[model samples]
Structures are given as structure tokens and as C-alpha cells.
Target: MNHAPASVWKNPVHFLAFGLGSGAVPKAPGTFGTLAAIPFFLLMQPLAWHWYALILVLSFVVGIYLCGKTSEDMGVHDHGGIVWDEFVGYWITMFFAPAGWLWICIGFVLFRFFDIIKPWPIGWVDKQVHGGLGIMLDDVLAGFMALACLQLLAYFF
Candidate 1:
């Protein structure tokens, strides 16, 4: 518990605070956080592409605050539980994916793969950085890698 105050446990803040406690899961909390984003994305169906993009953009903006606040509350520089950044970053990864379950699966799997592996520049960012920006930035780079690979596959196929 790390002595988190009772106030942080209230309302949607708690769920958001705890990353719904998905971050507390014994294994692969970041993957779970990104997976949670899929349902929300599904609910936003039929909106224009720009609308989806806007939602992702707004989420990134909001994630900056929520992650920092949640981390502060948790008293860890970057609590593994604070994963809104991963959600937003994964959402960005799916931006170029065509709207379909197959693409969704691909995006989900590939994003998780890159995020977990943290190859090259992504790994660099994750290891060398600090704070909320570090938490989010590495995932953002992971998303870029996933997006690049997916887009490349799309182009060839």
C-alpha cells in the first residue's frame, strides 16, 4: 500500500489511480493496461478518424497529469500501476490499423511485444530517463515501432 492516503482511493480517481489496480497484477501489468484501452476504443465506433486521433491526443494530455498525480500519491517515481500512459501510447499504435478485430489483435499483440522487449531506441529511453515523461515516452517510442512495423506490413500486403 505504501501508505497511500484514503483520498486517493475515492471514486474514478481510485480506479484511475490504481490503474484499476491492473498494475498490481503479478505479471504484465502494462499489457493489461493497453488491453483495457481496446474496449473504450470499440465504444467510440463510427467516429471519424480525426475524432479518434483527437481522443488519443486528449488522452495523452490527460495522462500526463494523471500519471504524475498517481505516482505522487503512490510515492513511487513511476508506479508500475500507473499505466494510463501505456494506454494512450497503445491507442496511438492502433491509429493506422484498419478498424477490425484482426487489426485490433495485431495492434494489441505487436504493441505489447515491442513494449515488453523495448528494443533499440525504446529501450534506451526507458533505461536512461526518469519521471512521468520517462514512463510515457518509452511507451510512445514502443508505439512508434509497432506502428512502423504494422504500416510496413500493410504497405507490402
Candidate 2:
């Protein structure tokens, strides 16, 4: 069912940008990329908050390049199969989330909702931005929105 170009497999940058092949899925590639991010979140969960934040920042910076390069190679701006953005976005959403499956699931749903719905500034950025930063910023906004909701839920409930 994968319509992803063969370049996704042959190119290392494309492979990573494609969420380690998860983005190659024919359906809901973004969702699959976010799902692929879970194991990484689990590994990072044990780190102190500052360390996690550091990694998050680094990931975002690197993602800009990765997404940009892959998009260039593919001749498509923000291709659905290039999902490094989703991975970073999901990580942002899970930042400081409680250590439990329930919280993880909630964070995932909230992130997916915001990413998919593309409300307000998220939608605005999606339209206005271009290239790799464009590919990443919208998802970054979605992650922050989802994170806000997650934090509020954790605080009140």
C-alpha cells in the first residue's frame, strides 16, 4: 500500500525523515510516525527534565535540516512520507507527561487532534511557511498546544 518512492529506502536521510520507514505506510503516515515515536519517548522518559528538553531542542533543530533535505531530494515540499516532523512533535507533546500508558495515550490523541485539525495559528503557519521549517513549525505548534492541554489535565485531574 506504500506509495513512498524507492528513494525513501535507499537514502539514509530520507529513511530517518520518514520516521524509520513508519511514514511509508499508505494510510495516516503522520499518525504512524507519531506512533513510531513512542518507544523513543519511553527511552527518554527516564532522563531528567532538563536533559529531555535539551534533546527536544536538538531534535527540532536537526529535524529542520532532515526534513528540508529529504523534501529537496524528493522534489516535494513536506511530503506525507517525510515524518520526522511528527516524531519531534509527538516528543514535544509528551514532554513532562506523567510516567504511565494512560498519559502517553492521552498525549498522543491530543497531539494527533491538534496536528490533524490544524486550528488557528497552526493552520496559518502551515499555509504561510515553506520548506523544512514550514514542515516542522506547524507540527511544533500542534505539539505545544497538545502539551498545554496535557499539562492542564495533569494539574487539575
Candidate 3:
């Protein structure tokens, strides 16, 4: 029922923050945004783990600015539509994952589960932090949580 502002389309920062407009969906924007990230993940999957990690660091840094500035412009804190966090979080979940559709699907489901469920410290950070850092941190934690689970699955199966 929530509609994204026009600036989400007009502004580049907002566009990126909105996960390339995936966040503009009327429902489950976070889910859509996370889905949007899969292609980028595929593109990056060929890189060495260290290089992918570097990209993670860079994207996290930029996401802070993108999420913060877009939130300021929209005058809303952590709007559901600002889903750059979801994109980065999904990427983090898939880090060092094996190359296969099965892994991709598993990572996606795990990341979404952690992100939506917000267990433990992820939930704690979601409540305690504010601004861009806060916005990104909860998802970062979710990503790590999902990554841990995915890595374990890979190890055991």
C-alpha cells in the first residue's frame, strides 16, 4: 500500500538506495530488493573471494551514504522502500558460496529468513542504532547470520 516517492525514480542515489527500483514495489519491497541483488551476485561470483570481500567493503561504505541521504530526502527513517541494505545483505550471505543454482536458492532463502526474523543481535541493533549506520548494521548482521548458516550447510552436505 505504500508508494515510493517520485524522487526514488528521479534521483540516482535514491534509485540505488531503492535497490534499482525493486524497493518501489507495493508489497514485500525488501524481498524484491534482495531478489534484485542476485544478478549482481552472479556477476561478482567469478571473482576471488578476497576481491569479492573488497567489493563488500566498498558497497557497505557507499550504502551508508546512499541509505542515509535517501532517508533524509524522504524524511523517513529506514523506510521500507530503502532497500540497499537488503541488496548488500544478500551479497554478504552468498560470500564464498559454491557456484550453483542450488546454493543461490539456499542463500536467498536463508538471507530472507534472517532478515525478516531479525534474531538476537540483529534485532537488538535494529532497535538501538539510528541513521545510515543503523540502517545498514542490522542487515549486515542478518547477512553474517545467513552466511554462517550457508557456510555450515556447505560444509556438512
Give the winner by lDDT.
3
Q: Give RMSD (Å) of candidate 1 vs. truth.
A: 2.9
Error of 3 at 8 (Å): 0.8
Q: Tell me the whole-model lDDT of each prediction, alpha carbons only.
A: 0.73, 0.94, 0.95
List the lowest-lDDT window of 10 residues for candidate 1: 1-10
**Candidate 1 off by > 4 Å:** 1-11
Which pairs of residues collide in candidate 3? none
**lDDT of candidate 1 over 1-157, digit per residue (tens):** 3333354457465467445655555566777778777887677646788998889778776676777676766667766666777777777777767778887888888889998888999889888987667777888888888888888777786
On TM-score, who's better, 2 or 3? 3
The CA lDDT at 8 in model 3 is: 89
Candidate 2: Cα lDDT at 13:
88
Clashes of each: 0, 0, 0
C-alpha RMSD by candidate, in order: 2.9, 1.0, 0.6
Runs of candidate 3 with Cα error greater than 4 angstroms are: none
Report the C-alpha displacement of residue 45, candidate 2, in angstroms: 0.6
